[model samples]
Target: MKHLTETDLRAWLAVIADPLATPATLLAWLEGPLKKFFPYQAVILGYGELTVGQVKTTHVLASGHDQVFLDYLPTAYETADRSSIKWWRTSRQPFFIDPENPPAYASAFEIDEIQRFGLGNVVAHGVLNIKANAGCYFSFSGVEGPLSDWHLEALKLMTPLLNDLLLAHFYLKSERSPLELDALTAQQRSIVRHLAAGMDDKTIGRTLNIAEKTVRNQLGKIYAQLGVHKRSKLIALLK
Candidate 1:
């Protein structure tokens, strides 16, 4: 596994931090930035399963007729793995599902529905907690090999980038009009993102490198301001 150079890492950070870049642009950025790190067809699955979002872009490094497959099985793509997707929701961790752990229809999944979709060997990373409120599965298939340590490391490196880019996107979107989200602090926004990701007080605290009590207090203030009583309600208000 080749380690990413400091200069390259810095370049990636700067790219993701750029304000003018949209998620579609960032998807393009990912294809270029991590080309050598993995071998698979990539798609940025937005809030829905299989129904590619507006952000679909592929690195030519990947070899697959992904677009053709998508066109042929559009309906199956949208609903085949909807329930399975929630696994990423609560764990908030990247999961690589293989033939060894293939989907079972008994588990509320439409197994035949997916195999007909013509995808193979899934590799996916979860994007936890963002404003505009959606969970993204950065996935790739059509590869031959167990995902390597380098692949996992690359995905891990991208997770926080995805978070911050989405943060910038939403903050800008919210502050664009008569409403001013500029008044909200960065910490407050971080709190909102984690809470929206379905994280509880303890997980949010650990992720933010703060105390659990601090997380609770932050949520208390956020709820009061948003006029919400539950986490779901708070997330709904924010979205």
Candidate 2:
């Protein structure tokens, strides 16, 4: 791996710190300024399940790769014991694969299949929110040597920001609009709006001139109607 100069590190940090940076914009930075340090030929980011036989990319950004390969991921790519999924299950740490000596976890068939795509190295890390029964992944692929210690360190440094941005992306994608709030009654909608404003049930109840128990009951009904079990999930959906 190449060593990043102080300036390079600062630039990478700037990209990560950008409050308005979307996943696509971050991906563009990964492909450009940070390429020298990470050297990935392709990249992907999204949320889904691997253990339950469901893999989907709610958001994806890739370069120097075919779209067909990504399109096949939900079906064909995931069914196989892909390296990323296998690693994600066993450990929370990032994992990597190189053509020289692939990990024992990856099946020979999977290795051959990956190599056939002209990829020689790959690295992946996952952020699991078990309560949500879902997780997010960041995958980087290269056509040459394995990722180096610097690359791993860089990713580790950026992991927190990546997880935050990825979750925000997921929430943004799934957030319901005001029109979608029609599913709830006016009172329920008012409660939801208060929740969105970061009010607790007690505070909301007091403000709305209702008892806390009433607020709880209303929240239960709202949760049932929205198919969510927790206040946080409901807030994310409504946000």
Model 2: colliding residue pairs: none
Q: Write one digit per residue (lDDT tens) for candidate 2, span 73-97.
A: 6532453556557666667777777
Per-candidate Cα RMSD to the true structure, in Å, reads 13.7, 9.3
lDDT of 2 at 152: 67
Provide the TM-score for each candidate, comma-separated: 0.44, 0.61
Candidate 1 has a TM-score of 0.44
Find the candidate with the highest lDDT and give its number. Answer: 2
Model 1 lDDT tens row, 149-206:
5555666776666655544544554342323334446887798888877888899899
- lDDT of all predictions: 0.55, 0.70
| Best candidate, TM-score | 2
